[model samples]
Target chain A: MHDSPDPGDRRDAVCVVGAGASGLTAVKNLLELGFQVDCYERETAVGGAWNWRHDRSPVYAGAHLISSRPLTEFPDFPMPDTWPDYPHHSQVLSYLERYAAHFRLGEHVWFGTEVVSAVPTGDGGWEVTTQSTGGGSSRTSRYAALVVANGHNWDPRRPTIPGEFRGRVMHSSAYKDPAVLRDRKVLVIGGGNTGCDLAVEAAQQARQVWHSTRRGYWYAPKYVLGRPADQVNDRLLKWRLPLRLRQWLYRRTVAMTTGDLTRFGLPEPDHQPYESHPIVNSQLPYYLGHGRITPVPDVTAFDGSAAELADGRRIEPDLVITATGYRPRFEFLAPELLDADEQGRPDLHLHTFARKHPTLAVIGLVQPDSGVFPLAHWQSVATARWLRLRLTDPARAAAVQQKESAKPLASWSKRRVVKTERHWFEVDHLDYLRSLESLLNEMEPA
Target chain B: MTAFDLLRFEDWTNPVPPADREVVSLLPEEDDGRPPLLFVPGLGHGAWAFAEHWLPHAAGRGFPAHALTPRPGGDLRAQVHDVVQTAASLPRQAVLIGHGVGALVVARALGRYPARAAVLAAPVLGGWSALGSALRANPGGTLPALVGGRLSLSARQLFQSGPPALTAEQITGYLSRLDPKPRAELLRRATPPRPVGDAPVLVIGSPDDRVVARPALDRAAAAYSGAPLMFPGMGHDLMLEASWAEPIDAILDWLTKQIK
Candidate 1:
């Protein structure tokens, strides 16, 4: 460590903005690459959103991982095989804790410390300001690079309907327990995996449940052929099967398992499989087939205790939940730093590297079909490799950056995703991981 | 594609089954920032070999030492999985020390697991000389190992049989606990795996090692470290043989002074 500097100008240190899975792994990889790192976390503990004790955490009591354990775990450090296919949120939290402790990542992290601002100093370094989570005066320090892993799920994105509801209306983030839905009529909006999961929970606790979706979607079962379905899909991708055949196989499997959506009085899928984000929910189909939950078209407006469906049908409910998803937010850094548009969606090169500033990267801003942790892990690995290349040979690193900047955004999934706000960051696991592997080759070739 | 890119997807989908092996550890009263050391014992042995001497010896000097008692398997991949899985469970990344066939296991496992550093002690690795040495030292064991049968090793053949020889009861107690391997799992005809990335490696053994020759250790050092740190007059199982403390002291010196 540098002895002392005026206001601690640590030229070798990289400032990381979170201690979540992405941030912790970033610190580990950076340290492995011989770079000093100072990670700041707003919460008192690590695991970020996975740690349910924190107020910003989106984890709920009924939550089990939608993706199976194999596809979800970090590549270097896996969850024990004793853990079931889909582990509970508490288990995931413990796994993250184990990861943090094993790698000694906690020592590098500054708990209860939050980065308030990070501005580029025009000399390829960033001046980062920090403040304690509790009331405290802010401190500023300068570092060589910045990695923004302040996750994207904490912000609430409650879509505006025509009129306000007279009764209770809340975002899914607030619905942490089944007690909120007990003996109540609930209306849940959106068709994301979380939406399906919340609806499934409502089936157990609520008096009546209604699920509203903007468009009919293909629902994949959590398991296929008695194995985790994602594993089966990954195998098909590894073999490089024809896209149409894979999609057909996926549709066939879902049909064989759950039958057609219309058979259960739900609308037929409007889009092809893989055109949007996957919703792996076998339980949602069971609840729907058992007539515990009713499927309806998207809600257009809220009138008192009633939500008017787009098909002109109205359903009255005690609680209306807007599970419309979250928008990625980076209020500390300038919008232009991340190349974020008006909607605050970062236009990162691989949904990671910032072309405007090669030293800047934003990890965990993706919504891949597989687990987010492994993707974040690979992203950090690639980013650390790039930064080390810069440290050793700036001219070559700059040339690589120039070549990479001209390439199109690396979001190449097998299926052409519909350009929608919800699927803005959607990526196929195989395609994204392949792109990252090739990108890593560019910085650290074999 | 990088080795990791191909293995990444496979490990995620169809991982190696979790290894149900035994682990023995020794801890220091005060840690002086030394990395943990994990030892994989040679063939026809259990973790008891290291737990007997090297573990307490290393830990006494403030290093956390561990040993893996791998389950007997015919395939090399199974042993590699055992080593990698046990290392991942540790509180820190360990300096992996492999002995005899365990050295080959550690080498292959580098493709899958990252280590703080590595040491191949009395390595049964590289060249036809290793087979030739094994043939000359114990024709009875080598002939059986070559034909898919367990190698027959008398206790004296492993430990130092000259000065500080093991007593008859000491020999019998250790022999009874051996985890013997079949011919399919021995070191020769091995596929070369990815090398350890950037971590410093130390190849330390003895020229007097009964089961391996000087040329074999030199080749192992050639593959990893630039030069072999030879501890002469020690047996093949350096961690268990007579003059064991001398080799371990050199290892501790290297870990503390050389790597840092």
Candidate 2:
């Protein structure tokens, strides 16, 4: 209710939307730089997606961080040593709460408040409107800059089929328990990590399980040589082997461990290993081999409790769960501000700063193959430093902005082919991390 | 009981049996079927290796599979004789599937016996280039196995750093079950039979195989005029590897076409 200082007096203030990992990091970095911050979160608590208890969270009962804890945790605040290598969603939420308490970030955040809309003012600033979740009262405030960190997993992209089926159908976001699959023939569609996990769970309880995938994916075990796969990848990078030799060694290792996936009736992966997001599920092959789960091709159409496959096979299932993934939705901001590409991915410099408006930035928008927390942390730091540099030195800010604008989108995206809409914002974790480090280095105060 | 239980050594005093060169048969559900499939192991490996997964899979697919375990103390000639004798005992012509040094025995034995078809999975054709690559990849294992009378290779060398699905305990258990081979047999230069005859041959190779290079496999396929099928990312142990079914399926498809 306008209890803070006048917007004109506090021109160095920044408004952060969404109190998620990116939002919390933005608040911490902005406050550390002595910038007054106003963070708005629709939820009553911190830990946006990790807060599995929240109604808006897409996390399910079986959800766990695909990346290990060490890589996912903030560098300044490491997860507890007692936590498992792959901590559950609840543990992640707890770790986020601990991070907020350690940095006193909750004080800067406005809990139970939603940012209704944010529009760029003509004077290189932002006109933000917020409303409390409890009351419908709207508040207008002006800020020197705006950081959108609302994340991209809330809106489920449910694909429409040509025909209708006489079975219970729901998106993976609506699935919370394996009880729905008990004693029923369940068809889990999609070859992503979520679909694999759900298929593994249903294999044990469902009367029959049919897994459908449109394309093949490289599946890696969670552990390699008794250590996490991501950790092994880091160690391998330090080895400094030639790219060809490294790829050969990695291919050999994967073949030895995962065996030939084609034997399990799945199609051969169309791309090389690590070329895209790998499905890291160890139990998938085991279940497929044991005949507890059957792998099928993509669904071409549905015929009353039966689904027709693209390969000319049909399956009669009692229920179907679509783990088809989510689309990046930023409805709070106007469409014109995004300048999205043909794939609907926003044209941001280094996946962070806007080319037209350097004052407006987006953090944690990438779907990297590995942990996103460290990447998000570095991105927020770069953004905060850039904002400060823009205010203090216009020439240097313009130079940095020019370089970012010239950066090619092809260099940022490494996929040979983007198969689905969900992969539109995908970034190779190692490449993106290096780019972030360089951007951070360039943004350092002279 | 596991094949290891039967072949388990009591101590140094108790020597292995000489008559243990008998063929171990894994018949399918039906009594009579098509020609049975015969599997031959490479250096330092026993019939138990194929028994792990391949034999059961082939038997389940209605093709009775058999593994030929050669007598302990023998040269390459004697090993080839053992394979020939085992094939003669089968009621009908059998499909020959050989791996590593066993492939050499199968190549020699095919000249003397009648086989429905042959599937060579990572065959060691003993060309200088192929031997050079094998030695470079695994000097510690390959050198000792060739020079000395004992075959010594670690689990890492055997499975090419071990498969992911198998735990350390499982690998150790498998390693414990392995028996040493006669070095003279593994080191001897393989002389390909004058002509491989009219028997259809399928040569399966792994491009990433460290033990058996693809060049040697290519040469073997060329010599036999066989259809060469290469699995791009697979390692040497095609039968025991996670994707063992790929080669199995290929062999099955070839056999189906041949029979028709």
On lDDT, the candidate that comes out on top is 1
lDDT per residue for candidate 1 within B59-112, as digits (tens), equals: 999999999877756367677777877877787777889998888888877766
Weakest lDDT window of 10 consecutive positions for candidate 2 chain A: A1-10
- Per-residue C-alpha lDDT of model 2 across residues A1-446, encoded as one tens digit per residue: 33665643347689999988889988877876668898999999999988877777888888888887656766444465446889998888887886676556788888899888888888889988888875798878889999999988888878688898999999998888888989999999989999999999999889999999987777888888877877676666546455567667777887897678888899988877766676889889889889999999999899988999999999999899999988777877876687876545787777788777878999899887667887787778788888989888989988887786676777666555446566667786666776766666666665
Model 2, B1-260: lDDT tens digits are 00101011111112112344757788999955467888998876778889888898888888889998867766666676566556645655567888887887787667644466887888876846545765686677667656544555565545645334456786688778767554533445656664222467788888788777766778888877655798766667777776778888888887878866
Badly placed stretches (over 4 Å) of model 2 are A1-10, A414-418, B1-260
Task: Give the number of the best model, judged by DockQ.
Answer: 1
What TM-score does prediction 2 earn? 0.62
Q: Per-residue lDDT tens digits of candidate 1, residues A316-426?
A: 998988888888999898999988899998888888988789889999888888889989988888888898889888887887888777776644434477778878788
TM-score of the A chain in candidate 2: the value is: 0.95
Cα-lDDT of candidate 1: 0.82
True contacts kept of each: 0.38, 0.00
Looking at candidate 1, what is the lDDT of residue A18?
94
